[model samples]
Target chain A: MAVVVQFAIGLVFGLGLVIAGMSNPAKVLNFLDIGAIRSGGWDPSLAFVLAGAIAVTFIGFRLVLRAAQPVFGESFHLPGKTGIDARIVIGPAIFGVGWGLAGFCPGPAFTALATGGGAALMFVVAMMAGMGAARWLANRRA
Target chain B: MRRSLCALAGAAGPDSVNTEFTPFASFLGGALIGAAAVMLMATMGRIAGVSGIAVRLLPPYAGGDVAGRLAFILGLVAAPVVVMMVTGSAPDLHIEAGPALLVVAGLLVGFGAVWGNGCTSGHGVCGLSRLSPRSLVATGVFMATAIATVYLTRHLM
Candidate 1:
């Protein structure tokens, strides 16, 4: 049952990405196009999307966090770390540059894979490799 | 695709025809994403962070729920198929960059997301909703950098 709910959430989230045009690389690029904003170019539609998502989530978390335990779990598994560090800043900066360049984040990239396109395939492989490399680096540090 | 290009070509002034703006749909989609994250939290006590979940499914991540992660990923990949069945067409996915650039971008995103402990969905959506200070900073940094990179690549270049 837990797995089923998780799968359903994934499905719904994926469909949302598709319907919102987020799965489209071009849409993402345009959203990130500060150049366009400066030149009076196309309006970034992603802001609305993010805003909508954040609004609902902000409310949802408030209500859910009040519960002592999850509906199907013993305890909530939230993130543990809470410090600002080089890894926090530098890592996302790098990710942001890549996001701007390729316009393919993890969620959309996975959805695009179903299309069986070469570009999507290439991006997925490289992303996996990148994640693997990060793990190796973290392991070495630990 | 061509329509988006035209939208890009024109001045997005108030009077310019907004050909590519889909605020309603985007909002609906975003609402769905938020609901999913909420459900994940309410039911399983997990963050519906795609990048973090994906990384946990990979090596060197300790004591992760392999089955649940696989189910989630499978659900993600299956969404397009469901869309096709319902709408009779898949979403438009085009990458203008060459292979090298695509690979480089992928690596950077993958590594950075993991190293940073989250991605757009993880930090931007889930964490921000929880009012985590770290997520706020992460989102701000990534968004600023993303805007700057696009500026450099699209306008400056």
Candidate 2:
């Protein structure tokens, strides 16, 4: 039952990504291209997407977290590390460089895998390889 | 009056600026995504962070609901198919990166997202929603860098 629910949620999330135009590299690049504001070609649709998602989530988390426990889980498994750290900043900074280059973040990249043609396939594969390498390095350190 | 107002808004003509601004669609989609995150939290007590979820599915697997995570990803892959059935076509997606760039970008995205412990969905949406300071910092840094990168690549390069 929980799996079913997760599958449904994933479907909704992916559809949202598609409808929001995050799956389109051109649209994403336009948003990232802040200089386009001068040329009158800047697209601010991505900001709206973030605003809308965050608004709903903020309200939703407030209400949902109040419950004793989730409907299906034994306990809520939130992130453990709380303090700001170099890893948090440096890691996302690296991710940002990649995102700007291709406009393919993790969610949209995966969501685009099926229909985004061969380029999408190449990106996903390379992404998986990168993920594997990161995991290996982390394990070695720990 | 409307013409002047439009000019003030920098929208004097459809071609002038923001020709692709679909505020309504974007907002609706975002709401749906938020709803999905809420549902995941409500039902399973999991954060709907795509990078976190995807990384767990890789080798040296983390302990948790592996099957559930797989189902979620499979559903994501199937979403376009559903859209095609309902709307008679898949959503449009254009890849500006060639194979080499795609690979490089993919590596950075995969590694960075995992190392950082989140991505846009995780940090930008879920983390901000929870009002985590770490998330706020992470989001700010990434957004700034991403903007800078675009400017450098598209403008300076």
Candidate 3:
């Protein structure tokens, strides 16, 4: 059941990327490439993605909170931490730069594999290595 | 939007989905993901973490969580098929980069997920929904890094 839900989430997420224009390298470039923020040249379409995502989530959370127990298991598994730190700041910074540059994140990359697309597979491979490096950094504390 | 460009250029990065969508469309799509995450967790007692199940793709995953993993994966695969049916034609596949950079990009993403402990959907959607500090921070980092990388690669590099 959890697996089913997970995939459903991934599917929705991927489809959203497809729909929101986040999956597009050019659009994403427009979002990140702000120096030359042209009217239509510098597109902030992601704001729409953010807005839509938040709206649905806000309503969804209310509904989830009303439930006694989860459908597939027992309770909702939410994050526990609350403070800002080095890892948080640095890890995502690197990840973001990569995303903006590459225009691909893990979820979309995996979905792209289904299409046998070239960029998708390349990102997937690079993503694996990047993850490996991160693990090393985290474990090594270096 | 051209296939050869993604295959031939240096711009294609695995985010090919972005190639086909508009800002409004992706926003709606994200909501669906967010909704699915909320509903699945509320009713299914799960957290919609992709990496957890992906780990199962490794070993000793045969029976431990195979059924659920397959189901989840199948659901994702089925969606595009369904969308294709409804839309009449599927989105075209396109990337703006060559194979070398694509591989490098993928490695970075995978590494980032491992290091950050989750991906955009897991942290951005699910984590942010719970108001997790880590998720918020992670999301912040993800966006910031993306902006910086673009600067370095496109201009500085």
Which candidate tops DockQ? 1
* Model 3 lDDT per residue over A35-141, tens place: 53542355677766766776777678777777777766656655565777766676666667567766776655665666645556567666655665666566587
Worst 10 residues of 3 chain A by lDDT: A33-42
lDDT leaderboard ranking: 2, 1, 3
Write model 1 residue lDDT over B1-157, tens digit each, in one string.
4334533643221111222878999998999889889988998888888887887787656557777877888888999999999889877766666688789999999998988888999999989988899999999999999888877666554
Model 3 segments beyond 4 Å from truth? Answer: A1-9, A129-142, B1-23, B51-56, B59-66
TM-score of chain A of 1: 0.92
DockQ scores for all predicted structures: 0.62, 0.57, 0.49
Q: By DockQ thresholds, what CAPRI class is model 1?
A: medium
**Candidate 2 per-residue C-alpha lDDT over B1-157 given as tens digits, one digit per residue, 9 for 90 to 100:** 4324533543211112134878999998899899999989999898999988999998656967898998898878888879889999889877767688889999998998888889999999999999888889889988988899877766654
Each model's number of backbone clashes?
1, 0, 42
User: Which ranking of candidates, highest TM-score first?
Assistant: 2, 1, 3
Tens digits of lDDT, candidate 3, B25-97: 7667667667666666676566666654454454445326577666665565555556677888665445654
Write model 1 residue lDDT over A1-142, tens digit each, in one string. 8788788988988998888878887788888875666556655778888887898999998899899999988999999889898988988999999998788889999888898489889999899888888878978998
How much is the lDDT of residue B57 in candidate 2? 92
lDDT of each: 0.83, 0.85, 0.63
Which ten contiguous residues of candidate 2 chain A have the minimum total lDDT? A32-41
Residue A109 Cα positional deviation in candidate 2, in Å, after optimal superposition? 0.6
For candidate 2, what is the DockQ-based docking class?
A: medium
- Model 2: number of clashes? 0
Instruction: List residue ranges in candidate 1 displaced over 4 A.
Output: A38-40, B1-19
